[model samples]
Target chain A: MAAYVQDAIMLLGDSLTQGGWEAHGFAQRLSYVYARKLDVINRGLGGYQTDWAIPVFEQIFAKEHEQHHVPKVRLLTIWYGANDASPAPSPQHVPRDRYKTNLSHLIHMVTSPASAWYSPDTRIILITPPPVNTYQWDGRVFDATKSYAEAVKEVGLKENIPVADVWTEIWEAAGKDEKSCERFLSDGLHLNAAGYEIIFNTLIKIIGENYPELHYDKLQNVFVPWSEVNVADPRPSLVKRPAMIGLAQL
Target chain B: MAAYVQDAIMLLGDSLTQGGWEAHGFAQRLSYVYARKLDVINRGLGGYQTDWAIPVFEQIFAKEHEQHHVPKVRLLTIWYGANDASPAPSPQHVPRDRYKTNLSHLIHMVTSPASAWYSPDTRIILITPPPVNTYQWDGRVFDATKSYAEAVKEVGLKENIPVADVWTEIWEAAGKDEKSCERFLSDGLHLNAAGYEIIFNTLIKIIGENYPELHYDKLQNVFVPWSEVNVADPRPSLVKRPAMIGLAQL
Candidate 1:
């Protein structure tokens, strides 16, 4: 009935996309901005890794395709890898080799001919995991988040998919203000509402340029609160601790 | 510093657990009731099935053991299997066998030695998927919800897990009241705030008996108004319709 097919974007990731902080996360924001033309389905789990996401892709998305006439998902955004860096029991870390394998598998599933629901025209966007703030590292291997992000970028390049380097953006932004890194994260790992806004704006810029017809203007702006965004103070000096025993204590 | 280990009750499931309804659903209510004694972590995702929940378990609970120094979760309540039965493409219905397999996998994961972070005393409660009111049917597979609920019950029996038959309770209450059923469900599938209250009360009755030490009495009662709860209208004869004139009269 229309000149062009409607765009349906499937957001697959962890807690970041799940609208944790007041339901104003990037996924909901993007939905608002592109509401008229784009149908966005947020399939994000709060604590999930690439390996876990793989099974979800199979169980939920694959299963959906097998059962119903699912609408063609034009854009597939894979934003994961945060939890993978954490020290965990599942051993589902984003090791370089495993990361590549997982990314390739995901791309294959969406672009494969066997995937009746997915078309060749479907555009897949791979977003690197965000940088972990220093506060998140309570003696854990939080620094490995960078390695995971690098691995994701490698896979994106090898697979010829568009990659959004969210890691670099956040890292650069934090480099200027080391004191407030912890505030950007809700639980030292996952992004709070403010962090989600940064990612949302980055995504809009990328998607808007590629698909101008999406008319992203219709959706509501989620990240315009530049002044109100509070960054947490990361320094112990800034903390108002109770005064320790002084000379007066004798 | 405390006498016994601090009890942590983790609620894992779909929209029902996510408190899709208005009054913060059962978990929030329970948190208030238990207050300081129990730390209630709500790990609910809207539209999540049992298969999807398994991965989340691996990330949030299983992975952060050594870092957090949190010894173990005292209790876990898993409520899922709703989205699995809703309409789909190839496997429109979750074959009973596959459903059982998924449930068993979940139970095994929780009880197995692999879950070392959780104490052996960790109690797992499996809740039967709630009923789908016939009146709420949007001409889809609303009838299939009963079978899905049955599948969950069978899994609970086989796994030797505590089962809360919410389906039976709700279905019996909505019997013969089609309009009442419609009012309860926001869609034919998910509950509105009012619908969650019925589930919350049912869960409290079961949990209260098992863990009296948890102390649910102090929780503020966030009851839905009687006018809000759906009650069926029996009289269909009072309706008026437009008169149809015969072609001869025209």
Candidate 2:
């Protein structure tokens, strides 16, 4: 076993991120790529707006602050806007103005030294929501969501943070075909496997280009491979030590 | 937030269990089925034999015993033999006599009150490694694996724990078709998606029949739904307080 647990990629967002439960979705695929290297923690809170996520973030950071000799979070993803972009008639709506401010506030809390889990080492990425096809989604919400996506882009620029502009990526992949775009969203809101594939590939590509060290191949796998273990004294090779064997034998 | 985190179904084994990284693999499917109900912890140690797994189990159980107020593990699966079945000269080889004794010891450590992390309420399971085709696996090891499978069944009968009996199940499912059998084993030793599908479905059926309470729908999702939240005072609903809002809105 290795001497330490693996760090994690924190997936923090709303319903879109929640759809990651499917085996082929972004969450599982990323977990697979990083099999022994990282633990992917999904904190997707579907139907939630930024206002509520703030406190949730605070709670998580508080817990991590006290944790020592544990897997530190190396990457955090902030993806939202689906619920916040809900039209006025919907209970989930958070006005675009507040959404923009909340995005900035959330970023500051993580990167700023004043924050509870203050560490400049972790890379934070902002993900903008993709456009919902009006034919399947609420027209009002779809229109409003576009603005929210743009607002997210603006926050990324202002905060000097890496942003996975998923909205443009998906639309371009869909080309001009309306039916093709529909293929990306199961209900014109939440992503289908294809949608998640795009997100997964994009995230992998972005990390490969910008934060290459966080790539799956580069990150450390916790345990020493069984082949590498001192067969006579495997006990000393445990994960806390570095000789624990991973099931994948990767 | 949920007042408490979800319990887990622990998948412990060798390379076969490690194949659960796929979307349709037993791990992902179980996690999806238990989406908001329970967390599926994959503890598959690829390329390991029963003899090697002993210390790893001790390290794990030791950690869980002291974690008060944390999510409890309701199920534990012990799968092995593939690597142990390797023929003499193979570094993974473990004699049948030692394998059987090691399995019994591992089970006792988990269920016996004398051991740490003992929770009589938790259910333990033993999974036999499936028959390996000689063409794919080393001929000597393949023959030995059959005996190991039988040994697992014997242990299950003695311990009175549920066994997936995967070895028999796969051959029976293949009927008379050799190609059908090949579909389940991607490699001579490890399972393909089809093989894992059989494991996933079989586990679901077993849990459905014997432990219906553990069913996903029956288990409570942590925290309240967004609609249930008091818009004025959402903090009252955090996970530690039973007011957590799930991102999936499940």
Candidate 3:
């Protein structure tokens, strides 16, 4: 069994989030930078919408009693708008109003003390889905997704959660032209490496600005550096320590 | 807190393994393929030797009594020898005999029934360190490193564990030319994307042959596919399921 040696950064949402494990994707980049500091637990379910995600989140996020045994989720990224923005009649679609409610509900599951999954230590950053390239795919409308992205920001504001508004960031990167989004979107829906690079950079900047303590540069490896390991008496030095560089250690 | 929804593949070793979280590295590739089926927990500590790793492993691997509370380690890859091959007098150096013993000790910690961390479900693959480009770096000697690689093979043979002979694979890929190995190695020490690609493919092949049941293709997602979810009553469908496709389910 894997032990709770390090806390985790859990990425939760749809295909956009699941694809974060791809090379050069945001999740992979985060894992590389936060290598020894935190484990990246990807709870991204491809093709999932906020409506369907609520129940899944309930099961995946440990209840209060189970928390003592599991790794703490130091950071949580809830990125969902993409699939939920699908036009009505598409099974993946969640109405914009309901989408906002679902996002908030997911957030409160951790932020609200009354909820079974509450964890005050878990800092969250909500992400708005990237812009769609209408010319490349017809599964979604550019405007509809834009509305869903807008809905996400509203929820973030109401919940006081930091938002990684990749939708607007990608839109401007594409010169506000939907077709130009092809440079970032592989199939007009999913992201390419270049697209994910933007998400990774945007996310890191958000971490630095809002949760600087959790920044990779600010955290230490849970295990001591090789040179620092006491060679003559290595066992004591080898025990896993907290990743945080406390004032005492400093 | 993160719930244990999936089993895991734990990668344990030195810088070579730590670097696996980098883009296009073996860890990222495995996480991509095994996305929903199994979470990839990286326990790779940089600049670590088999000697330093044992104590670290004791804390990072859950003991038998604690196993029920944590995620099962379905697969483990022990890749060491790069730093240990450092010449005598270097702090990182472990005599060839002791290096072999340390490697076996790590395997036995999980495989031995009487061991505290014993986990019979965890299948292990022993990976030989990639061939070093002696012309580009003087930290290690080519022949000395080759001897360490041979030692890993001996350990795997004696332990009856599968070995991902990446040393031979990378050497042959470099046309057996020391300087040409720069094509795969970034600084003649750590691997480049091309080098990691070889490790990923070779490891996959070993898994296919030795532990076919654990392959990503054979394992179902712990969560139901969106299309298969019982939409009206998703709570039942959303409950976490084992990744294995049982005979009845098939």
Candidate 4:
């Protein structure tokens, strides 16, 4: 097995994060800014509600960690709610009461000592679903999203985790300009490149202010600098002893 | 070390591959298309010449394998030549003879028995640099890129590896219109989203036709479907004997 490991930050959510994987995309921006320092893993599952993801999270975080030699996860951004906010009739929708329960359970399962994937150093940031442009999301009810976002915020506060309120952040970034929502949400739901930009920038700023240690400049690259590479023996550079302590269950 | 290993496909190249990490980017498409099947790794280094990468290659591939547990690398794409095409005065430029030598060295090192990283079943593809709109890339002499591309094809032919001649393919895909070049390149040098779309589609098609086993439908996600998940007993899904035997040096 290869020994190279980078501290990873996970983007856990739904289609918004999936769409954020594009060029100039949200995850891509973080990747660009953080390059060798940390790998931004996109765990975004399109069309998924929080309920389905709970088990998937166990696989990716808990079970996977129990089995695989993947990198240590340093920061996990739990961004969900888009699909959960679907109308009650939609299969993707989760009832408001259950939604809050799911979010609260998710936070505790991942961060609490009662769970298998818990690591004291691993920071959890909950992100609410971004504001929806109703016309583009099959006439999705915008109020439903706000309510779900509120649920996420409540869990973040009760769980003592940081939160990136992309829902409010995106709308405010759009300002009073008419149709500016179009600039942010390409299909009134999924964000366009511009919409992701605001989210990406905002998250980076949040990390800088609240999780300064995770900042790009503060972290080390996976390997030695090009100048320090041993032209005659370069293997040592990529094989720095992995700093996995406190980062992974391993 | 983490025991779970994800089969990986490495995109080894320069800026095109690096920039290709964007939304609907080449690697992202592979990630989406191959989710749960194989991990698509971006080993793209910007502003790198093949010579500089040769040792770094050993560092990333061979030594790291000797030290840690990484998922097996089932497929690797060696895409280079863009930076090498920089004019004679540029530090990034390598002489024509040396460029071919470097490409040849790279192919053999990764594929032949002389290297520890070599595995007979590991598929290797050589991707020539994409079409360079001469006026956009420093008004570069077009013939230079064409020559380097031809050199890559020759190596691929001699080594019996697949070659993606993006330089020719993109141009033809654009239908040879006078300014069709503009549609494929964002800065007369790098590709825009439209151009990447064609590359992403073509690569997927190539995998379908040539590397059918690498197709998405044929692969398995890293875990069991949520329905089959034990909920009470989840580790078995992730600990399944790794399919890494024929895939990595490990």
Candidate 5:
């Protein structure tokens, strides 16, 4: 009964979405759980910061319009900011002020003249990045996740958009289980399948509460167990049953 | 001059480098232009077929090594295949492949095994994808690039790599305003940057050949023109200037 269920949902984030895990990772699960109804597009790049995300967004919008003839974006869930916290190769990061600037620009792009070719009724959901586990320190002092989370929250508040504080939830979750930090993140930064599941569920919950029309059924309840999900090599094969399960099967 | 430059050189290739661009790509360019104080690492992701580049290489490698301790992969260049010739969103498009595999695996991870960990011998380069501009356009084709160049060769091949083909060179270059359509690419297939440059240089020779190595010059005369370098954003302010550039300036 989610409101945005009928709308095309675009998941815009960084590595989290890009690394489609087994049963987790919000995008994959959402597509599986929702199947057939929601036209979900996972436009996530692995090591991208907001700066890079901007251009990607532009390109995606352009392509979508060119191909589909749909101008306005219906719903966008943006989970970025991790890469922005560090001095990575692409220089896609933006320090606090710049981060805010970039976030605002993204908002404007989806809602303003630049995105005029698209739908005006776009609802943007900003998900704060999950916390970085301090268990594996790489010598940087500040918690990149926390700093980025705060920046995202600031933007959500200023923009009057719905914000999901995934950072606090993850921080507390990791804090409770100090022994298994690896459970949450495969790497210190990126989330594993389990971590993605937690995120996917959280987003589902948020969407269910906020937008009732989405009709997001709990995939765990409706679909087969994760073990039977048929995660064979994603490579397209000639065999009839390649141990692979498409989103429709979910 | 010196037994293949002490500086690390990356001789990246696809199944094509497995073929050979001989006079056109980074291999030939380094032979002529680069100073003989560098070493090259030819980490070609052969038969790699786009979407598999990152997850198969960069990510796993990043996880295996420590950041600073990793070898200095000072000079890295890659030329992938005519293999990613599938349909759009069907695991063949460059952007999707980059998002799913290449960029995440290679570009994002700072500690990529493919990189020259702390060896002071690291540098990254991307080559443009070879052209696939010609095919039997019977509307029965899944990937035109596979035959002529639209496959997953535009982005990483064009943007991330230092030297590139991007297919247009042979596409437009061969006919001399006559649209030969078939001369440059063998089987409408691969060519190194050299082949591309044969066309690229013909179009913009001065800018293509000589430009200062503004960023990393520890291994001088290894100049990759700024214009030729296509990153998502190559603006001066976006990235942290490499320390070598500062030293070189001093």
Candidate 6:
């Protein structure tokens, strides 16, 4: 069984977030840096949208009563809108207004004191879907996706959550040219290594700026480093310790 | 808090295993394939040996009483021996005979029903240490490390556990030439992407051949695939389901 040794950074979204496990992807990068500090849980469901994620999140996120039994979600990145921006004919599509409401609902499930899944210790970050490269995939509209990205920012502002605006970041990275975004998008929709590099960097910067205490650099390895291990009697030092710097074990 | 939606593949080992979170490393590859099917929990502590690991594993691996509260560790990979092979002068060194005993003890902790941490559902795989290139690094002797690798295989056989002979695999891949292992190893000790590719492929092959039920291909996503979702009434379909194929929810 997987014990609750370390708190976790949960990434919740669609294929974009699921694909974060790819080599050089944002999830992989976070896992590397947070190796002994925090576990990164990728909850990204491919081809799913805000509407569908609502029910799934409810089942995956432990409620207040179940807190002690599970690992604390110290950091959560809600990256959606990619599938929600799909055309009207697509089942994945969620209208911009509903998308915003769904995003807020997911956030409130943890942030709201009255909610069943209230977790005051969990810090939330909202990530806008990357700009769609319509030329590469005809499944989505460029302007439509851009509007959805805008909606994500608006929700972030209202919810008072930090937002990693991947849309604007990639848009600017591509010099605002839609076709040029191919450099980042693997299939006009999902991100490639270069695109994930941008997401990882932006996400880390946001973590450093907002949740500095949770940054990998600010934390210690849950176990003492090798050289620090007491050779003659290591059991005392080998016990799992808290990663938070200067924080005594509870 | 993270709910126990899917079972997990827990990797327990040293830096060689902790480094698996690196780009193209075994951990990342496993996470990608097992995305929704299973969660990959890396309990890899860098610079750790079996001596130090026993205590840490006791704390990290859920005991019998705590099993219901945590994710079921369907597959557990026990990879160690790199640091333990250090020569007599080094504090990390654990003699070959004692090393074998330690490995067996770790296995018994999960397999032995009498043990406090006994977990019948957890399947274990033992991986030997890679060959050391003395020309590149003086920290470990080539023959010394080879003996340790041999020790792992002996333990695996004595315990009737499958062994992923990484030592022999990489050594053969290097054409029995110690210096040529540089292609796989980043430094003389750590693995690079190429080295990890070999580990990932080997590990997956072991899973496929020995534990096909737990293989990524045979398992279904905890949540139904997006295309299969019931569009009109998705809540019933959105619930987290077991990943084992043809197996009804318990």
TM-score of each: 0.42, 0.88, 0.98, 0.79, 0.42, 0.99
The TM-score leader among the candidates is: 6
Whole-model lDDT for model 3 versus the true structure?
A: 0.92
Candidate 6 chain B, poorest ten consecutive residues by summed lDDT: B241-250
Show model 2 residue runs off by greater than 4 Å.
A1-4, A60-65, A117-121, A176-179, A238-250, B1-4, B117-121, B138-142, B176-179, B240-250
Interface RMSD of each: 24.4, 4.4, 0.7, 4.7, 21.2, 0.7
User: What docking grade applies to model 2?
Assistant: acceptable
Query: Pick by DockQ: which candidate is best?
Result: 6
Overall lDDT per candidate, in order of appearance: 0.56, 0.72, 0.92, 0.70, 0.48, 0.92
Q: List the candidate numbers ranked by lDDT, top first.
A: 6, 3, 2, 4, 1, 5
lDDT by residue (B176-209, candidate 3, tens digit) is 8989999999999899999999999999999999
Sorted into a CAPRI-style docking class, model 5 comes out as: incorrect
- TM-scores of chain B alone in all candidate structures, in the order given: 0.73, 0.87, 0.97, 0.88, 0.53, 0.98
- What is candidate 5's lDDT per residue for A50-161, written digit by digit as tens? 7666655654453324423221244678888776776444354567678878888888776675553244545778888776655653522246657888989999989887
Sorted on TM-score, best first, the list reads 6, 3, 2, 4, 1, 5
Model 5, B1-250: lDDT tens digits are 0001123344544545433323344333332233222322333433445445543343213233342222234445545545545345544334434433563355444334454322223344444454453462222132444342332344445434343444555545655321254455544455534454563343223224432341223333222222333465444322222223434321
- Candidate 5 or 3, higher TM-score: 3
Q: Model 5 segments beyond 4 Å from truth?
A: A1-7, A21-23, A62-73, A87-92, A113-118, A137-142, A176-180, A217-250, B1-250
Stretch of 10 with least lDDT, candidate 6 chain A = A241-250
Best by lDDT: 6
In order, what DockQ does each candidate have? Answer: 0.02, 0.34, 0.86, 0.25, 0.02, 0.90
Candidate 5 has what TM-score? 0.42
Q: Higher-TM-score candidate among 2 and 4?
A: 2
lDDT tens string, model 6, A141-174? Answer: 9999999999999999999999999899999999
Name the runs in model 1 displaced over 4 angstroms.
Answer: A1-7, A62-68, A88-92, A114-117, A137-140, A176-179, A215-250, B1-250
TM (chain A), candidate 4: 0.88
Candidate 4 residue spans exceeding 4 A from truth: A1-5, A62-68, A86-97, A133-140, A173-183, A217-250, B1-6, B35-37, B62-69, B86-98, B108-114, B131-135, B138-141, B170-189, B216-250
Q: Compared with the real two-chain complex, what DockQ does model 3 have?
A: 0.86
